[model samples]
Target chain A: MISAVSAPDPDVYLMLRVRDGDEDCFGVLLDKHRNSLVHFLYRMVQDQPVSEELAQEVFLRIYRSRASYEPTARFTTWMFRIATHLALNWLRDQKNARSEERLDEQWEVADRKPSVEQRMVYQARLQEIRDAIASLPDKQRAAVLMHKYQEMEYSQIALVLESSESAVKSLLFRAYETLRARLAHMVTGGTR
Target chain B: MNCPLLSEQTSDVLLDYSAGRLDAARATTLQKHVLVCDACSAFLAGQAEVWAALDTWKAPPVSISFNRRLWQKLRFRIWKSAVPVAAAALIIMIGFVYDHKSQKSQMEIDQVERTLDDIQLLRQFDVARAL
Candidate 1:
């Protein structure tokens, strides 16, 4: 059971409604979280199709388990915990045979006309960044993605990763340290 | 202010500062320290660069059919689970019919046996009267 907080979370409320067979509430939850969840999975696995498939599975699992849904934590925390589990399991299964094809997949930004040189430069930088992220250990990769991209707080990330807050901090530190070493050439003295 | 890099536990202060998660007062303190502290300065600069580079890797927009496909899969799952139940119900109905037919056939056989017994008794009585 979720300990009572000062204010109830709206998503948790929606989930409770879903538990009571409110189909529309499920759709609301899906609309609210679909993009972020897909993006998170995309970053984790670096494959669009796989990410989308996994996100679908996540939502399906949630829907299937709605009968027993309990507001034990923040909705996103529970959602991301399931996502992180799937992403990690996928990475583990594909170890030593990771795909680089999706790394070269064109992003939406590439749709705008750009000079050939600029496009080349953009693709090169993107590849370097992706490779650096992909090079990290699976756990560290997950930690950095949640921390840097998702902007999840340490406690929330800890909950997702099933670790203590300090451990999460340590993971983020080490992961960032590795990224810093790998991408140090891109620094132009600009503020973050 | 003590440098955040001096200890493992406090190292995330630098990260928090870089990520803009530090409070205003602490951010100001870290900014001042970054000016004088080369290590923190370099760390912040590199982290910033990493963040900028990561920003370039935009996640592809989710497919337009994502929700549709998901709903389809869900419907399929419902069908998958329903198939077993439907089969069980059909089997139960078949069993009920088979049991009813067997009982009817047994009653018919009992009636035929009674008729044969009565015929044999009548034949034996006729023979006794002839004697």
Candidate 2:
């Protein structure tokens, strides 16, 4: 059994308990961060099961490395540091293997209604945005996802991607540019 | 009304204007340029749609057993750490028990040797005849 203070949140206090050998503290941590982490990784890999698998691996690493965990950074920064590394490596390997051409696949539009034209339009729009994001070179996708989805400031993203803040900004700018170009239809139709 | 000024504002409009990362002064910086620039206005409009649509992309739901699986993994890792310590302790306990038994055996051997030495000495003294 876990205490109330430590059971509900993934705060630094709970993490401190985890560091001190409270195995259950990790369950609390997983509960708190699991949704967000899964979301972030899902945007990257576009596969639920793979993201879930990798998420588990990430937490396992956190637990295994708890002995050396320091308070030098926020627990999330350390956690995302590991997560971003795995994602970037996976992207790199996918590049080498020249993956299954996700740029043209409209996988994100699954499981929703398609009868009405508006719903179809919405679905198409979602697919366009997803495909545009997927078509971005790996770094740009990472930048875009890290910025917009993960809500990381430039400095935090820099830490995850191991780049400088200015560089991260520039990457986001480029990513935004690509997204804007590909999504020009949506933008143009916005005020029309 | 200058073309260059409008063109300069076009690039920055997409970065800060659309992402909502800009403050008042920076947003004001683009105001004059966007007033006359049709292309930039169109681009920003598109950004709004894309951003909104992207927000609807809910992640696939995590499995119901995700936490359980994570806990299982966590348990395994915890046990992995404890295993070495347990093994080392077991080894130490076994070594201690073996050393203790060897010590006991050595004491028994000493006692047996004393008895044998006494018996040999009596034989050398011919104690059987009670001379």
Candidate 3:
């Protein structure tokens, strides 16, 4: 169990150790942040394998830039900034490549026992939410994911996205409004 | 669907409220206002559901070999990057050594030239005295 009395930011300390030639500290940092980073990339790009690849690239970048790592911000902020930049570039590349080849690979669904009808409904709803999120503009999508999944503060989201707190708030507001318009039926049982 | 009681700024306020970013005093005030404003209340409710549905969405766990694979790639990249740096340093070191040797030889050549000049001047004086 983690203690409530917050210790000094372990990620920063570990990063400093990494800067000082501790290869093991890099492993520790990767283990600590791998899930969150991968999940963020997965949500950003909507592709699991690509997410994994990009997450590895993000870590590689961190290792490469370790010599210049400064504790000016929370380690996660700097880390996510790198992840966001990579994910956005990947998205842009996908966009450019879309004209040449359609990336319509089917994602693997989770294995669970349910009535076929029930599974169909669940999968349909899940797809709807995923499509809605994927439809958001890149920056707004990033802001929403960082805020919702990461439980990051508006300030932290700003830091990751390189925007002001007010701008982050604005992005969240607009993103949620669009989501609300699309998914409100799920809540209110109203017609779309 | 703008409510009469809420203005455009209310959207920002409502988002902040739902995100738990509003302070206690403002949150309490918004809570009181939300009770009376059905449209804003419904909007807030929908946003809450969006949050809930998003929370339900989880990524599959990374493979167990993720760490091992990442470390391997990272090590390879570090070494690959070091090669160029090492080569550049080697080049710079060689350049510095060559420059130092050239400077020393140039100084020695100048000293020899000065010595020859001195020898020529002395020989001239001796020749003049003999004449």
Candidate 4:
């Protein structure tokens, strides 16, 4: 089976190709990393459609910055560095545009619950987790996504965030602490 | 045993410990600290369970059309930016050819000057012969 051309280490080759006006390689890279990047952005933005659109923008940024690609760091680290910057900037712009943000209008998950009662319970618990995640400070939310979800080591995270490993750890600790406080009641009851 | 007020340091190390990154000696020290501190012990255990639950924190499935629409938008943007670059290259190529044509004309002009000078010399020789 001819699987999609796999991109392992030294994606510098792809970057170089992209520098030489090779948009195909960029497309391949985008397709390869889209799902994971989308998920990461989803965690950051807490909005599905917005995350998808934002992720495409991330790749476009990468494409434009092809001329400036240096192979000093792993491609993954470089990509997240850009992603985090974009997400943070997005948060800042949102805050500037609106004095205070509106609550997220969550789209319902279908067939995830068995009966009407189960559906209501599932939706409530889901909403609680969503709120807990949203209530976390932007940096902590980003740190949590990058560490817990992305499975990046602390050093890689430090590179992405331009912070020390200790700082990332502290951020994650605070984020986890916040989650514990907010969701402790719902953990067992799965209710409001 | 005197424990430092900075338990957060140990907590970070404990996270690394959970990830199996701590050296044997350091791990032993941290292991001892957790054993003595009930709060740290519970926190680590609680985080581990939360992490396990979070393993399922995946986003909902996106529509197939989502990828198509997103990539199309990206392509349109890139296409817009690329048009100018292509036009610039075309202009550069045209300029190079134009400069080459002018250089060839300048060489022909120099050759024509030498031909005219030779003809003048021949006419002077004919005039002298007539004298």
Model 2 agreement with the true structure over B42-125: per-residue lDDT tens digits: 666766766876776666667789988888877787798899999999999999999999999999999999999999998978
Fnat, model 1, is 0.66
Model 1 agreement with the true structure over A1-192: per-residue lDDT tens digits: 253233578999999999999989998999999999999999999988999999999999999999999888888889999999999999999887766565344644566667677667767777788899999988889999998889988888888998888888788888888888888776462222
Candidate DockQ values, in order, are 0.57, 0.29, 0.28, 0.19
Question: How many clashes in each structure?
Answer: 0, 2, 0, 0
Candidate 2 per-residue lDDT over residues A15-125, each given as its tens digit:
788889887777788888999898788788776677788898899888888878766555676778788778778777766443232322343445653446655665666
Give Cα distance to truth, residue A188, candidate 2, Å: 6.8
**Candidate 3, CAPRI quality class derived from DockQ:** acceptable
Best by lDDT: 1
- TM-score, candidate 3, is 0.74
Per prediction, fnat is 0.66, 0.46, 0.51, 0.20
Please give, for residues B1-131, the per-residue lDDT of candidate 4 as tens digits. Answer: 33452354445676667656678999898888888887667776766655644553557565467667766877798799899999999999999999999999999999999999999999999999999
lDDT per residue, candidate 3, B12-95, as tens digits? Answer: 677678878889999999899888888889888888888766755667777788888987887787799799999999999999
Fnat, model 4, is: 0.20
Ranking by TM-score: 1, 2, 3, 4
Stretches of candidate 3 exceeding 4 Å from the true structure: A1-8, A96-112, A187-192, B1-13, B19-26, B82-131
RMSD of 2: 6.4
What digit string (tens of lDDT, one per residue) describes model 1 on residues B29-113? 8888889998778777888888877877789888999888988988899899999999999999999999999999999999999
